[model samples]
Target: MIQAFVEGGWAMWPLLVFGMVTIGAAGRFAHRPQLAQLRFIGAMSLLTFVTTFHATWLAISAVLSYLSKLEDVASDQLVKILFTGLMESTRAGGLGGLLLIVTLLLVAIGTLRLTPKQG
Candidate 1:
């Protein structure tokens, strides 16, 4: 797990930061459901999703660039290398996505609290 994170390069660190902030905001919103918290959660959710894909694509691009630099590599070996890098790169996005899902669930719960009670 740690190795996969390390393989994600510098992008993982920022994604981690964003994910943590989003989770914190979402948790707060779940507890209180304030207008300001709602707005912040919405924005943070979007930011987290964008950062997730950005990190994923960045890692994929790096893999492709590295593959291009190789000369006369075996076909099977190349495939292995490509997949390994891709799998490693996806770790950041996967973690971000998991965080986003959790935060969204919290946001949904918070929204439920916003609905007026009826007899």
Candidate 2:
């Protein structure tokens, strides 16, 4: 159902597989029908989704940089393109700072989201 709406792309297969596997595993240890159990499953799935989003954002960022910078090069050589992307992003913000900011922001949002409900 989600794949249908999200345009699936290449990431759908991997995320679907992971979601199914984890949901199944969690069911093994807990009663999935319970609300708390469902919430946990949701949190886990959201985490996985966030990880995929970060990875994909990085990949697309790299690809765009490579394509825009490379000249007179064949597109078939994606491996070379990938390396070029890594080098460029690394040079842009030195990898650590950008990833740190992204990760910290994600953590902050998650913290706010998971805060206890007010009375």
Clashes of each: 0, 0
Model 1 ranges with Cα > 4 A deviation = 115-119
TM-scores, each model vs. reference: 0.88, 0.37
Taking the tens digit of each residue's C-alpha lDDT, what string does model 1 give over 52-83? 89999999999999999999999999999999
Residues 1-119 of candidate 2 have per-residue lDDT tens digits of 34232432345445445555444535432421333444555565565556456545665675776578877777678667777555433322222233334434443444444524511
List per-prediction Cα lDDT, in the order shown: 0.87, 0.48
Top candidate, metric lDDT: 1
Displacement of residue 47 (Cα, Å) in model 2 is: 0.9
Each prediction's RMSD to truth? 2.7, 11.4
TM-score, candidate 1, is 0.88
lDDT of 2 at 15: 49
In model 1, where is the ten-residue run with the lowest total lDDT? Answer: 110-119
**Candidate 2 wrong stretches, greater than 4 Å:** 1-21, 29-32, 73-119
